[model samples]
Target: MKNDAKTRDELIGEISRLSHLIEDRLVPDNGMTDDQLRSELGLLRDLAEQLSESETAKVLEKPAPSGRVESYQRIFANSPISFSENDMSKLQTFFTGIRHSGISDFRWYFEHHPEAVAKCAILVKRIYVNQATLQLYGAGGIEDFTDGLMSIFHEESYRVFREELIALAEGATSFEKETVVFTLQGERKDIYLKIMVVPGCEETLSRVLVFVVDITDRKDAESMLEEMRKMLIRTSSKSIDGNNSKREG
Candidate 1:
């Protein structure tokens, strides 16, 4: 624990020192010593050199399309978000091709985990948020389906889910994990919702990024895994009891 605390303090100090360095670069002050400048550059250069080619290869796999981040920033700053796919498509300036990292990740997540697409419903702008966009992005359906998912969101649930996001935006609180759940025709089904928020993130990051992973299959697997764990514990206990009985005998 002492080591962990020391490590955490070191990381925090590094971040604080780096922030000061950025400020120092913009507005020069003699507060920073000459050696500090050299130290910082040396550390950065070492970090760059230490990065394995395989890691860079992943980011460099696809060239981000032009004007992606700039356009996205513009839309985020200017538009009243209406999360509909058609409207999102209209924001073509935000993402032209699948070259942008954010777009690529969004595309990958949507296609791979359709259930994750609509999970951002609470935080989404009412105008831009819709089933169409979710479907196009493969983020799953916003509404519950009659065939399997008769899910409905109550007022309290909405409050609990959305309030956290608004609070994060307002700087009242921050969270690493947030969840939303659904009940089908009053019965709890496998459908669930989740989101990740980063309020004090850097310039390249958005305030929040939500994921809707359909855990139906995963939930089933978990149930089986849990049962196995229980069985193992019971067997282990029985074995221990036998060993103790033999020792007593």
Candidate 2:
């Protein structure tokens, strides 16, 4: 037990150190190579995983829960889908600026200015997430989950997702689309996302609620079915050609 505690403390210390390194390396003018930055992030992820295992074991060693803990235990802690709440005030402001400039699709602007999205990522924070989010993203806690947001999305998917989010913030009511998200362990999952803006009592947008459903299996099945259909069509065409040649002969 003493050794376990010592190891846990060491892991925590390493996690903190790596986190600082990651922050420093992410600066635009930072001199670190991409490989070096990725290496540090990888080490940080490993340390976080070890810490998570230790904490989970500790929780399991405790007695059965009661009261609020017991009541909350049955929530979406094990659900297959992910859900998150995000603040969209900054996005709304961005939309307002674009609308003033008569920009129909803000994607072009954002693509040209990658820093804009990064800035928005800092301002438009994700405030809450369900347990499934943490499990899906392999996050130890909400802080870890939020910190990994930029790295968790595929490049193209992130761009499209941002565009749609901006549109929704500009009074589009709701938005839904399929995109790819990367887990903390670097596994990619195709997800169907539904985003809705919740309005306050004053009839103004307050927060955005997002639902992320892992649709990787469904997408793969669809692709397989499409391939089978194309194959069947090709076979039928060949058979028809063969019969015609026999009739001609």
Candidate 3:
């Protein structure tokens, strides 16, 4: 079990490192050493081979899923509201660095170091998303969703979200807000979102779970209702004033 856990950790780390490499490639870079790239690639190849020979066999021999597991699977696969899970360790590290630098306000820090904020955006890793999330964003699959993740988020919403994440790292349990997002097809959407930090075994935040509900129609309805209410009030006030004026005459 100890060896299995260690191997799993190595695999996760390598996968995350590879993701960072891909993100780095999106921008101009000094370039990585050929030896370094080859070494990491070799390690991944070996891990994949080991998993296919041993872990795959074990999984194949495992017992069938129980009713509870099936129920959870069904809900995750079929839920109407969109949900996503993000690995937050990279984000936590960024916050830690800022805090140690004597930066108290994230907004000030971001404003002073816009380039750092832009780089930090790449650190956000979307580990999983449900089917509803795919549908909501018009994403064909996880790959499609992640390819344009940064573009999908409104700039202001991204800043707001980063602030909320910093609050979570500082001991807040959950955060919620109504923010704007864009679909893969570039349609703007109003979303009400709730984010909760999932604690690790050591009680630190391991992951962030985001629950998103599209509220565009609801917002439009509320705006129309407010306008109608104001109009009615104005008309009623006018009638009351006319009655008072007639009585005075």
lDDT of each: 0.36, 0.59, 0.61
Task: Give a tens-digit lDDT track for model 2, residues 1-249.
Answer: 456445544544544444344445334364644455345434333433443454432433342232233222333355344666676666677767877888877667777777777666555577677788888788887787454257686786667667775566445757777788888799988886776565341124346656676656545534533554465556668779889999999
User: What is the TM-score ranking, best to worst?
Assistant: 3, 2, 1
Model 3: residue 68 alpha-carbon error in angstroms: 11
Off by over 4 Å in 1: 1-151, 154-163, 166-178, 187-211, 246-249
Candidate with maximal TM-score: 3
What TM-score would each prediction reach against the true structure? Answer: 0.31, 0.56, 0.59
**lDDT by residue for model 3 (128-198), tens:** 78898898888888777443247577786777666675566566757877888988888888887776665
| Predicted candidate 1 versus true structure: per-residue lDDT over 136-211, tens digit per residue | 2333554333221113444444445444433333333223222334444353223333333332332212333322
Clashing pairs in 1: 64-99, 82-127, 82-128, 83-128, 83-129, 84-128, 114-139, 115-212, 116-212, 117-139
lDDT of 1: 0.36
TM-score of 2: 0.56
**CA displacement after TM-score superposition, residue 120 of candidate 3 (Å):** 3.5
**Alpha-carbon deviation at 74 in model 3, angstroms:** 4.7
